[model samples]
Target: MKRNIVIASVAAAALLTGGTAVAVAGTQSSSTGAPTTHAADAAGTTAGESFSDAAHASGTTARASFSDAAHAALKAVPGTLDSLDLDHGARTTWDAEILGKDGKWHEVTLDASNAKVLNQHIDRDTDAEDAAEAKALRNADVSATEAARKAASSGTVTSVEFDGDRTPVWEVETVKNHKERDLNVNAQSGKVTQAPSDDDGDDD
Candidate 1:
């Protein structure tokens, strides 16, 4: 009977010690949890931080951003800026439409954060759409350049295009800290205003 008691006590002690070891390990594991990914790496940007703020924070400006994009697009194909826009997604894309050397419109997208040229595509074969866009552009007294400048005041302009409406407005897309937004400027007046809505998500 005494041997049985001793054996049971030893077993109970072992169990208690094992449990204590596990508890210590768990505490250590939690205390040294893996380092968190940065907002830039995770592509998680805060909302409401203006584009100008983010750009300034990142050591850039709205004018510089436009200049960088224009330089990159023009370097690839010397052309005039046709239109502009900002693509919202995992990253804010600075997209510019340029009437390229080939005399075809080229869509160029840049990384708003770094102003790295992302992609360039020869936008071709949509004659009807092109005509409408051109007509809208002509009717607008406000240049895409002016719209971009105004947009950079609130945030980084990612894009500028004529809204698909009868009385087309300049659709300006901007981003700050990765949060995307669209603003509208009266084509004739250049009065900037919040857009009524965003367009369908970009295919890219």
Candidate 2:
């Protein structure tokens, strides 16, 4: 079990790190977690446009393009625009199924700086059996937000998505009464979706 930082403040709830929220058994909360635009892409903008502006500016290109997007997002974050960095190697930006606080899957994406926010989408097509498995995981302390992809081998996460949308997450699973529990994680910089689990089969 690895231990990572968790930020729960609504003010700084951006997903800066890569995909999925990773955690160990007993973790603590902390500060600092982990942005956004377009003309800024063509001519660059000030630090007043919401973070989303920077994300959509570059669309889907290369890591360098994302770097440019990160710079743009930093410039538009509101204040004097401090420093910003983009890890083109983040997994959350590419994964498809991101967990959320509601113990459900959601679409997620985080900027290179992980300081801004974007909207969330859900996977309506996940097979009911798989959905049930995911729900079971959620019930076993698994975070609905992005969960750190435990490296199976030495493969890089190409692209990620939840059902179909993009989003961020912190924690996913927990342990209660000696049993793994399911839930959502928002330790540090990340996003968490809240979708009800009442949809039976009309999700498709």
Candidate 3:
């Protein structure tokens, strides 16, 4: 009877020890899984931070570059003296002092969003009556020499002058019938401004 009791006690002790070992193994496995989950979460957070930082930096750089370019371009434009604000957009009409290739001061209208050349008024063309009037005026000058007549038949002359300001009917030089000639024309009322003169300098 004493031996049997000792055997039974030993078996119970072995079973308890085996259960404790299994529990410990299970706890270790659970702890390992938690660390892996935490590691994955940290990696995801780091990746997101990196992407956000890159996007923010890119946006900042783009804005700075665009601002710099815009400032430089605006400075380069000449005669941008004043600006006007409109309902839809601002109308930036540059100073009308900038002379174009046609020997006339031209005003440029630019879009507020983008600087675009909307319209341009360079030089005015001479009309038939203005041409005749100019010829008569030049005829009055005795000392003046006359060149072949080149009519401004294509268009009418808004103004004619030696300098920037438009004066009375003045001289005109044009190509008519494939021939270049220096003629005189009138500005307003199409009166005789000047006659054809060869001795004076070129009309245009």
The candidate scoring highest on TM-score is 1
Which lDDT values do the candidates have, in the order given?
0.46, 0.26, 0.22
Q: What TM-scores do the predictions have? A: 0.51, 0.26, 0.21
Q: Rank the candidates by lDDT, best first.
A: 1, 2, 3
Q: Tens digits of per-residue lDDT for model 1 on 107-202?
A: 777775555777888766556666565545444555555555556555444455655356666666555544556688776777989877525566
Q: Pick the candidate with the highest lDDT.
A: 1
Stretches of candidate 2 off by over 4 Å are 1-96, 99-104, 141-204
Clash statistics: count for each candidate: 8, 61, 13
| Candidate 3 per-residue C-alpha lDDT over 53-163 given as tens digits, one digit per residue, 9 for 90 to 100 | 322322211111111211222233322111111112233221111222222223333332233344544324434543343333322221100110112231111111221
Whole-structure CA lDDT of model 1:
0.46
> Comparing candidate 1 with candidate 3, which one achieves the higher lDDT?
1
Candidate 3 backbone clash number: 13
Global fold similarity of model 2 (TM-score): 0.26
